[model samples]
Target: MTDTPGVSDPVAGKTTGASSAGVQSSGRTAARGMAWTALSLVVSKLLSFGSQVALGYLLAVDTYAIFALLTTAMIFVNGFQNPGVSKMLIQQHDRLDEILPDYSAFALWLGSIGLVLFLVVGIGFEMTYDVRPLFWVIALAGLSIPLKAATTVYMAVMSVNYDFRAISMAEMKRSLFYYVVLVGAAALGAAGYTMALALAAATLFHVALLKRATPGLRLSWKLTPRRFWQMTVEMRWVLLSSFLFALGMNGDYLLLGEMLSAEELGYYFFGFTLVANLTVMISMGINQALLPLFSKLKHDLAQLRRQYLRISGAVTLMISILCIGLVGIGPMLVHLVWGGKWDPAIVVVVSIAAVLPVRLTANLAGVVFESQGAWGWRLMTLIWDAGFILICAFVGATLDGFNGATIAVALQRLVSGLLTFPLAANMIGIAPRRTVGFFARCFTVYGAVVVAMLLADPWRGVSVHDSTLILRPMLETAAALAVFLAYNLAFNRELMVAMLGILRRKKTP
Candidate 1:
């Protein structure tokens, strides 16, 4: 279930006795979980990406702009609904069942609050910007909040069981369902109505699927003032951390929503959403199983440190390759997939892709720290990250407009991600220097691949709307990836071997 390609039962064999058994079980769980999650997420992302491509390609730029802005607001609102109740429950899962009823109440209340909050924000936005038809868009998106809450309780159960297969499959189905509806809606040209219908359908599916998946789990409508208050107090740090993290992540979109023209923002959003969602689809898809796995190893500091290096290192390496690969092919991808109309997003996507390796590293380490209950630690890092990005985005946007803001935000992410290492070292109980090999290996591969891409004639010109030109970049990316794979084979053999083993794993009787 963990995305770490560097560990399984064999790696866990470095330890002995009860700790060894625990690590072994976690390894096995992680291996099986990662297998299903990886395979499933590919399908899920393809489906989700298809829908998005449809939206951007078929719809007008303004239509896409309205869609992106509405989704940005909706995502921002959704973030505040849960501080980390489900995450904390995964850590202290033994008591999860007993508190399930109370947790349901808390989640429901949060969703309800978020719904009202989003509505108010929507009204304010329209009043301020005079953006039309978007208020209804906001309303439809906001209404999905409670329906999503309906799935939270059962999802917690799945997390406790390390059932990433169920979680991943559900996400795949949701994406499939959403894609079907969204693409169909885009075809009919009722952009706002299309979004509203798709959201309603996808969210309702969340409730129905999880209910069947975790049959014994049930939601409670009854709320208790005392218990809710107690839970809120206990989760205060987590709540603030969650809210800050959300604001930090979404702050750029919120800012851009105001700063850029709808068309410009739409182009930026297309690029951002592509990589941003792709990043999460790949990163968090695996992180689904990492938290509980990390929690299990929290007490085994020696094993924890080892697993942290192996897992986080491998993840960073993959991100490096992805960044390099995307940089080489980004322009052609825009042409091949979404059309020449989205050419403005090419630089946006490439710039964002360039800095994403560190972001992924921070995310993988993030679960490690969260598993250790370092809420305060996480909160501080997020504050700096959020603030840095906001300042950078504002200045860049003001000075040069859309492209400047995109690059600035990317730079901010890289800086914040790198600086979190010292704090991450303390939280993960490792020496900060231990992660040096990670940075060296990833950077080496990135440099080598980029050099290879450049040597492969990355600057070659292609005719507009000519589909044949894409093959050149695709070949260039493939060659670049070959360099990455060869570099790993030469120096990262053990990690690669372990990753292959994990991918080949199957469920045992």
Candidate 2:
């Protein structure tokens, strides 16, 4: 090798060639995985949106509120119980096959604990609040915890292997099954109980599919104590962050349910869901991919920093445009879609839509923090944000009812973003001044668009009840997007170039 294994050595050349081929193959696999995942998220969101539309029309406001409340409670419980063990399994660089049994066992134990906690809470709610219907619905839905836990274990295994195609197929199947049951139940005139029952059925079906897809993943209750403790230690902050974040997001719904009538809660929930869906879609599509991508580059700070800033900036620009456009046309779309029944939600949508970009930025930053294993900082940020939202929501609801609550929610998002952006930027090696300047420019552009829309009065003649309800909103949204695109091309050409570069990289290998 002294003289033969140099640059011109045939064996060395073959080795280099094979190494290059391996890198190319890996890149292709990653690209395909991301594509499948993105497609899955889009399809799942569309299906869920369609279901919401159908349910919005089919169910009474109070019924929808009850369903929303139950689901919100379920989310809160799940968040509270998340130990992040599954996430640890995904992020850990070990042989997953060796740990599968232990992970399964831990998940099963956790599920049992969650089930007991839910039952106790249900009883307490029945006793304290005396909301019999809500208590029963939550109690029945709580039965799905074990099924969900099992599904999570299987999903973690799949995710670690980058088998996103399997995950996507499973998700699509679950969504389809759930919607079928939901619509059928609604057609049969079932109320909140329908949601509870559908959740149980869908989860059971999902677990069955997971078992079939992932053979030999038998649920175990034999967790190794040492491994369990290690996971707990690793995931302690993640669990706290999850719980606090969940409380921040869902605590308002619980408060509103307690203070307001079901119908009023329904109106707020509808508006919140509509506006929040856009944020969720963006987060799911982008943030979900960021963790794995960032993980791969964790050793390269410069590359990570460049990617973080570019992606975050691009996300901000895109979301700002969407939010500004929605500010112009959201109310009209709501009117056209749900008519007079949901007209009360218009103000809520407008207020909440204004906060989407801020909230999304903070959310995306959390993904970056997680990828870098910056758990303590993430926890602190989440705690601060959650506390702010909780206090603001309580005060706002107390002061001015639902609309005030919506405003408070928006203000909370704004404060959270302002406070967290510097911290996130610092962790990612991005300068605070740069982050602030970027957001300022985005805000200025968004503000200009809003002012222009107000001056134009695009929705003055549109009527929710009229057949031509979609025309004005469509025209206005299209015009707003066109103008925003032109503005970006002129002033933010660098952002566009960076975005294109990102796309090219994704396609290159």
Candidate 3:
């Protein structure tokens, strides 16, 4: 049997026998870390969704939009402070204990700087735009920056040490705090409640937990100018790549906010958040499991490729099916679940769902590059964004004014999927044509399933008021999905086995 990525290669084959040992050890460690992160993510997403649901019911969509804008602006400003040094520390080969303190100090100083920046920017934006309430949100949300920076380092330590239990507990605490606070504060209404809950969860709670978690954690300004310079130099490229990727991923919301009204943006944002959450769950789960192990098994490219496809294909398949089903029944489900007020979101919901597989694929590509220490590929994210713009423009020209924009957003994902071919090829060292073909196959499968569902619909005779009208779409969609999965598994037996293995392991001890 051949060695697998994150399973059989380490030290680039220089110390073959010993490297195998490290790979074995690291795999277990990374798996443990992933387990904890998964737990936290699950809990956090659940609580967050529930909180949002309650808030939405109580608050108007406009208030939600305000909350969204504040959160987005805060994220944009704080982006400058986080430069990925935490990953550098975690991924390095040695001396984590020594490395941890430097990172801690750097985080503190960066947080301080970030806090000041937030204040200045918050005041300026709020005053100029008459968004004074945002000033308070920014001021309060500012605390998450340093706390995030610090928690980031602490999480890095956990990953490096493979102590996922601690990491999971910390996240669980954070999520629980957010839900409890949000629920309690919702009594007062939306804006204040959201702000208060965010502060408690992200800022104060994080800091307290981080401090308790790291008994000896300390920060100092003792680092030499030379070291700081080196850190900056190394981090700049990674930061650039990360920023581009984040911008590309997030820019659509900004665009929507500018091009459309608040109500439209609100619908788009909610749908986008829902789909993005699903993508995050799958992509992050695999990545968190794979990256640390990849550090140990860097040489086993073949194994890496196999494992990559196995995990990625499974995720892609699941997301694809869920997305297609949503497109068919999403509007109905949204109406049924959220009530009449959220009816506007149904159109955008299906539109956003259409691009989920593409988004997930691109996210996976980023994870691959991140694991390989390939910062250059980050530029591809911008290229993908360019495609988003192009497709958005195309859809706008073809469809009804605002509806066109929303549809264009989904079309952008398809364009992004096509655009990422070369990037994926470069990252994986596969032929560009072949790599494109692989993704094309995925798209074809998903599209075929969707097409079949549409074909089966009895459009000629179907009545809107008939109970069977609603059930018909669901039934046809389910059948199409069954066919899609059967075909997918038949063509990719290894992938199916791997997915089965993953599921079995989850069920096992």
lDDT of 3 by residue, 438-458 (tens): 676577878766666546542
480: Cα error in model 3, Å: 2.7
TM-score per candidate: 0.91, 0.85, 0.83
Tens-place lDDT per residue, model 2, 101-195, is 77678777777778888877777666654244878887788888877878877777776666677877887798789888988888788777878
Give the total clashing residue pairs for model 1: 2
Query: Which residue pairs in model 3 clash with each other?
Result: 5-304, 9-297
Count of clashes, each model: 2, 0, 2
Ranking by TM-score: 1, 2, 3
Model 1 lDDT on a 0 to 1 scale: 0.72
Candidate number that wins on lDDT, 1 or 3: 1
Candidate 3: lDDT over CA atoms? 0.62
Candidate with maximal TM-score: 1
- Runs in model 2 with CA error above 4 Å? 1-34, 216-219, 224-234, 281-287, 317-325, 440-443, 454-470, 493-509
The regions of model 3 sitting more than 4 angstroms off are 1-41, 127-132, 190-196, 207-230, 281-287, 383-401, 452-467, 504-509
